[model samples]
Target: MSSVLGVSVGAGTVRLARPQHGGPHGFVPPYTFEVQTLAMPEQRAEEAAADAIAAMLAAAPEVGATTITFRSDPQARAIRAAMARRQLTNYQLVPEAVAAVHFAHATTDMREVSTLAVYDLGSSGLTVSVVNARTSDVYQCERISDISGDYLDSLVREQQIASGRIAHPADPAGLAALDALCRAAKEQLSNSNAVAMPSEQGLVLLTQENFEALMMLAIESSARMTRDAIIRSQHPVQAVLVLGGGARIPLIARVLERTIGVPVIVPAEPETALARGAALLARPAQVPQAPAAPTILPLDDEADVTPAWLTAPARRRPLAALTSRSGQNRREVSAAALTVSSLVVVAGIGLGLGYGPEVLERGNSTDGSQAVPATTSPRPTQAAPTSAAPTSEAVHATVAAPPVRQLDNEPTTSAPPSQGPNTFTVVPGLPPVVLPTLPPVVLPGFPPAGQ
Candidate 1:
């Protein structure tokens, strides 16, 4: 830029900056800077900015190259109007956020910053801006109306009144005066441990600790809003730049740093940072192409998102998706094994009922004498065999034989017990004098009775 004047017209103050230059008249010594503070209104800020610049030029024609910053349509209109009225055309308007980034690049080691959060705590309200460091494009921004310098001033005023240090003013003019006094005290408290101001009733004293205590909630609210802006931007912010008069209060940076979990950057002159940055833009300087905002992950310092266990890992998640298939399989196999064992038991019981008693009777034959078998039930466990009568629903063997282990594959006959192996015996039929020998009985799904 051919001009070197940077102007930022804020709600509470108008900041102007230009390079150092010597006076155009006579042989004057060179001065470092020729800038002035102007009172600007919020609604007509742009128009006031134009008026102020024109007035400055009128006073000092050699203020030299001038650069102004503007953000809205009204600013442009105001600049055009100022130029047309002043009969001068040596000015350029730069975006305010872009100018601040330019200042950051010039002053500090901003290599770590790609996305910058400009927390401007001005008089009327707070504006949180997430801007790209390279192009100075705003990615996300928010205007918080609840907190501001004026609000903090009110808090100080109320606390001072409550302490009995000052009586509440009766008239509007007096109230305004007291408020102004409190505002100054608040600003002083930023740099000093305590500030004492003369008021209506007495000297109102406010300490730095007390001031921070009174404004803790408001600063925390600003931090919360800033965190939200970062989350909405969907890009991680490396650092934050604190601007405006409120930035002078050290507590704001501490709370913001703790809450946002990032560095809160404050320049040498925070109240005039924007103005100086604009002034830098008014001059010809290299604007570094900062790397693209790093998007390592979605960042929410508050981390107010749905819990991961509730929605993620839809397949085979250890916590949410437990399977019972193995337990069910084990139960199914046990049932099958129980069924096979039951069938084998029933078949063995049937074979014993049909043949055990008959084998015992054949062993009791009188024609051959032999030693009795060692296997026998106790006398109480056995029942006597008889052949007197037959009255039964069906024929049955009454012997409950103990299982015997076969030692050899040879046929051998064993003598019956002296009593009998039967628990109970069925009676023989009438008119049946002799009984023939019974052959071995074969049942399905079994080997022959004798090999």
Candidate 2:
């Protein structure tokens, strides 16, 4: 069975999901790689993303295609280059907000809705998209990089520091651990009124109210952006679909619902929703195959190959035999005869020019009444010596020879040259002809011909 791997590369984490073969529609857990986006360099973040994808591929070797979600074009390009370097084919890149919208449409109760506002609060920032739910198309999307889940985490950390809950806040490892703890406490506050986190100094307690107070500005800004995106889409939003790790906070959803005045939906697996949607969009790459060889039949084979209906009236004769018959039609016979005669005439003319007029004399007697017995001369063994300048008679003979006549058939032998008027050599069967090189007849006003 074909399967797709959906990868969501967020600011703080990279998540992967593959749809179960026989699971219920819109249901599947995802694998996530914990990677800090703001804390790590760009190169390291990309490396983390690549490592996550590689791990997923190693775990699910059967995945046929992959779809990755990215928040920005540059991030998408970087991830795409990394995937290409890994020789991964049949992969697609989609915007994070767009993928989240697709997930909302597939899993949430917003399937029947025509338009929706999707708000994705990731670790790095918040992105709002106006989606045409009926078509699963994103019309417009807006991103605020400053107001995000990570920003809230930072605020929570500051509050913890001010409350004197921990020490060594400047230590890199301690800061990292505190951030993780803060994220956990924030997630817990979504479910309960308060939560506790173990830090370097001691256990830090965070209340839902305190968490909301710290993240209220970011939440309000995100809600405003979502409203603006929906208004810009110019489509009535029936509901709001929220996703991303940062969006798990209950306060974010409640504030958006109150601000946008629409029902807000959070999927059962909020973090994997984008990945699942991406997987849904993945398709197996089609490998082109060479066309099958054509079936050939032997030329010598003889059988009744005509269709039964076509042969029902009468037996068909061979096409070649039918056309070869002499009495097939008077027009056809006349045309064939004409063509043959014309070809013979042309061949005789060509031979007369190449070998001189002697070839035409064989067809007629000296008196032009009967055919002559044409003689063949022995070919010279050596090159014949050039003759001296021609006399007056020889000049006339060369210039006044008759035009060669067209022959009815090919000549078997050449004729001998005989003396004619003015000592000109003539072939008996040819007619008198004028020379083509003779001066053109000039008119009085034509600039004296050549001029």
Candidate 3:
């Protein structure tokens, strides 16, 4: 069997994973390791994505075959467009939620789950997906741009300015540093009650209570949206699999558990769930088949880790030309990657620009709005939040075949605390492969709270 590498292309970051072993029991701890250190610049559309992915492939030379995942149609299109730029035709893009379901089948108990709600709160946006765990069909999906990790970071910056932490550095470097500090505080607040850090100006301290109060309004709104999605799924949702970097926030999980009234499950490292799933799906496995001839055979969920709809996509997406070594050699230097001036964490990007989600919200309905072309200019200043009610009933769109009926095996992973406020992925000072242009910065007194 050929080895496959899994890459999850997020708006702000890209994560890659490769599984060492595969079977019906699925991949376990130490078998799958995910690398999520590379950050994608958002100013340019396909150019940035291409560069980031190309860089990722170059960083990992052992990869043979590869599979990638996308959430929205825009991401799939963008990935294709990026491939076209490099004349890379041998590439496939699978749905992000489907990849997560594959991972869930391997890890979580699938005995009772028929439908699933995947709530991902990443750096760029909030994507809520209602999917059939059996058929891999997307029943209902929505994206909220205004309330994301970046937006929350901006809110923290606004509060910092209001509290007189330091004068707003008009230059990009200063702005980046301040935003990084704010992002660190937010991530630390998720795991601890209070976080104190030193900056160029003074010591910054943020309490969990203060942080929750700051984001409670936005979190509550998202919770309502999750509840509505579960109801709109039109099927009994057995569990809610919360994925993404922001999913680290305990408050987000608590509010979701309370609002959705369903058990919310967070993987060992919530942020890399999709990438790890992609890694497992990338593998070509020997799926145990139910014996023919009406023989009495016990249902062995462990030996049967096959997904009807998921396996097809992964198999269909295998491209001969997109291996690690050849891809980088074919076309990596084609795009110009404009490096950021400093090692600034862009967690507070959306709201940090002094704007609101109204700028990000194109149109949100029961199903969700179509993705438009991304603009290079900054989002317009804050305005009234706009929302469109669901005009039509939810359409259940199925992709392919069999349900993932894996045994109720609790999956495990040896993931590092890489998703923090100040960074998209990777522990500070320990990125998998550092970009040549943007080097690391050193802080004197500030404690790396989240890491």
The candidate 2 region of ten consecutive residues with least summed lDDT is 30-39
Ranking according to TM-score, highest score first: 2, 3, 1
RMSD of 3: 54.4
Error of 2 at 212 (Å): 2.3
lDDT of 3 by residue, 1-451 (tens): 3456677877767777766643223445444574554575764544665665576557754444566888778778878888788765434677999998988887888778899999999988899999899888888888888789888888888887789866777799888788889888887776689998888866677888888899899999999988887787677787899899888888888998888888898887888888778777664434699877854556776765455567755765565445765778655543323233221334244345432242344333224543334584433432222554222221111111212222234344445445344444345556543333545565878765456
Worst 10 residues of 3 by lDDT: 394-403
Task: Please provide TM-scores, in order, for all candidate models, with all chains considered together.
Answer: 0.57, 0.59, 0.58
Q: Which clashing pairs does model 2 show?
A: none
User: Candidate 2 at residue 311, lDDT?
Assistant: 64
lDDT of 2 by residue, 273-312 (tens): 7777776677767789999997675556676566567664
In order, candidate lDDTs are 0.72, 0.69, 0.71
Over 4 Å off, model 3: 21-31, 44-49, 52-62, 284-451
Q: Give per-residue CA lDDT, model 1, range 1-451, as digits (tens).
A: 1235678877757878765543212222222344567875577676677777787778766555667766555667776776777676767777667777877786777887899998988888888888998778888867787999899989988998898878889898888898889888887876799988776667889888888889999899889998998999998999999988888898999998998898888876677777777766554433589889955567688864655667566544764434566667788999999999997886577455455454454446454332234584534333433443222211222233333433354446754333333323345432222334566789999999655
Instruction: For candidate 2, report its TM-score.
Output: 0.59
Deviation in Å, model 2, residue 260 alpha carbon: 0.8
Winner by lDDT between candidate 3 and candidate 1: 1
* Residue 252 C-alpha lDDT in model 2: 79
